[model samples]
Target: LSYVDGFDITRHWGNKSSYHSANDFDMTRHWGHLSPYHPADSFGIQDIGIPSNCEVSQVHILHRHGQRFPTTAFNDGGNTQRFAYKESARWWASGFFDNSDGGSSSTSYDLLVIPEDGTENNTLVAHDSCRNSDDDIIRCFEDTTQGVFTNNYLKTVLARLSNYLDPKFNLTIMDVYAMQTICPYEVAYQGSSDFCRLFTEQEWIDFDYALSLRFYGNRSFGNPTGRVHDIGYVQELLARLQNQYIYVGNISVNSTLDNNPTTFPLGQPFYLDMTHDNIMVGVLSALGLNYFKGSPTGLPYNITHAPNPPENF
Candidate 1:
């Protein structure tokens, strides 16, 4: 990463060979929302623990395949089934969740499948309100960053990784990315992948950087309607938090479920709802949490010593 990507942390963890465990090289850790459950960096407040005077009260887990970051979750490889099995409690997950062995019959009521017929409003799956048009900030970020990424990041990655390949076979940018990406998947399903060893930890982090640019911009707050896409669940969450049914509607909140106590029970000690990882990120913006937010204006993050953000906001 010193000459290849110039990552800041590369100086510290650059070529150190001691940090060699499967845990150290796990690419799933850097997949943003798709990443497995991990602790946020200890930057804000330096301590996130509640006051000692306070006692544990309510718990709401907005799960994807398993536990995610604060107020969000996602689905991943071998870890996917591990979560479902460990929960052992109630399972309120998406019906579409299909592992290698399918789902357990014990958690039948947990299934929530939304048809793409465009009628189900209270769903995090492919929100149409936020994605109805393409001329929004998503397109802007893509148009602005994709080329820069290709010319700068992708080119460097391809050149460095190509050295390991046979000279008879040429490795394109797509080939490099695909090979790097398949690590997480192969590990999740098949248990281990040889591709996992092809890149350094910094390379994985940089590839994760490229992915962060795409997902954070296209699916979450970087887009114009980022929060709006996942507001339904947010509202439902508030209702549960306050032990009251939501009164306002016409957006994503499906009144039928939120209104019904059977579907949306109140005063529960714990709550779990599984959805898409992309929406999990959008939920973060909807809740207005600044933990992962690098910039308020939602401009793409630049990995430079001094980032020259555009003026005239």
Candidate 2:
């Protein structure tokens, strides 16, 4: 956490590279994907200066869940079969997995069994203590019928997690993508883990496009032509949020829980909630924070350019 101003040209003299820069604070939003977290992207204690006269009162916060593999909606195979096909073809051309007798066909991921040595699988192990020799890793890339955590997603995630821990840590996936997204950042600073590093930059961009299709595609109402803001999805999210609280004036107040035993916001000084990015955006839209009847030429929803540094509430 400690850093010097410049490159600290003392690497030969025993100083490690701990340089700091003002650019560290400039934040970029990657929509819960595998993006590095800049120190400046988040608030630091010192950055939230102490008031000279006023005392701190209450605080409320909401944040998106961690970066994860694409959601089940995209992992369902049909949506991502094309990407998998392309990536596998590239791997086949590169002879990346040729060290093993993983079969001759790159498209048949089921037949591809990774070799123990001389292959990148040596660096990849899952949480189940199952090394990469099995078809788990390739299953993620090749299997078109797999569900979110069924085939290889959870195992790959855990194996990647086991790399940094005491090796006995039973890292589990909670049937969600946020945890999947969040865990890799722990080892991201180390710049290791091939499972997390499997995609090229352009590949990631393509992967993002697939994700956009999952969220904003024409499968749902109000999504014809791949509209960015799906009115149906937005309404659904608002209805779900309404069951818990109602937006009153400038803030959201909890709905009366006459029959429920849960405590209200009576004694709590701080409240924190973690949810999907779509829910957060939907909440903002419900509040009419930046309401828009954008024209067809306007920026589409999921495909549009996001605000630089992303706007803060």
Candidate 3:
């Protein structure tokens, strides 16, 4: 985390986190779920367009819901929901479809119908996405981060703030991270916040990596229940692609909905389903997209390197 040198005046920025394994990127566009919609081109696929000889057929499009407030206070509903109804099609949202976009649509149906990427897990998840128990991966990640993984960064940050912070306030390392996270939210709420310039660019990158590390263990493939979250969606996709009524009991997949032809149509031009960002990660894991699983720069969640950041980083 370097300084802005206090010389440049045009929106000079110092940061302690970056969004993704991006290049000389200036803005923080890699803040994981909180980040703006960026391409998943990290896969390094050469040809993205459809082949000249092959025409577009059925397309299964899965994406996260629009920008919403943090799930802490309110549900993640946003103004972007209305736009989904701009097209003429039957609308179906997942189970946790609490946010209603005026219940308006271009289709004959008065309200959005059917189940989609909403919180539609009506059944009980065996693992239930990892509880906050001490044995959970989250606890493991937290323990590692606060210990050998990043003791140096935390200690250094704590040391750096010893003189400036008021003696009345005792801020711990977690509090320091909370301070770092506030910058993005503050910028989003208003136009800006001085908090954005608190840290240098390298610090921003380190924080982002820390976050990625946490997500890797708790939300993504590192957790036992990670891929299972999207297993239902993958089964539905396969049913549509194969044009069959394949029914299998799953942790989250609704059998009644899948069996009904009216609800689960096999043939369609394109299907759009909205889901949580974590579920999409599960989908990637379910599909075995190894491209997102690693990188030459020692990314893809090789946590073995975390304890030795100086050597690998």
Which candidate leads the pack in TM-score? 3
lDDT of candidate model 1 versus the reference: 0.55
TM-score of 2: 0.32
For each candidate in turn, the TM-score is 0.66, 0.32, 0.67
Residue-wise C-alpha lDDT for candidate 1, range 39-114, written one tens digit per residue = 5454445656788789778987765553232222232222323244224233322233333233454454443444
- Candidate 2 local Cα displacement, residue 22, angstroms: 21
Please give, for residues 229-306, the per-residue lDDT of candidate 3 as tens digits.
567678878888988765764666667767777767677766766555556666777787655454433234334233
Query: What is the lDDT of every predicted structure here?
Result: 0.55, 0.32, 0.51
In model 3, which regions exceed 4 Å deviation? 1-10, 14-25, 41-44, 66-68, 73-105, 108-152, 246-248, 295-313
- Deviation of model 3 at 14, angstroms: 8.2
Q: Per-residue error at 83 for model 3, in Å?
A: 13
Of 1 and 3, the candidate ahead on TM-score is 3
Best first by lDDT, ranked: 1, 3, 2
* Model 2 misplaced regions, further than 4 Å: 1-56, 69-203, 209-261, 291-296, 300-313
The C-alpha stretches of model 1 lying farther than 4 A from their native spots are: 1-28, 33-55, 66-119, 126-147, 161-170, 296-313
Best-to-worst TM-score order: 3, 1, 2
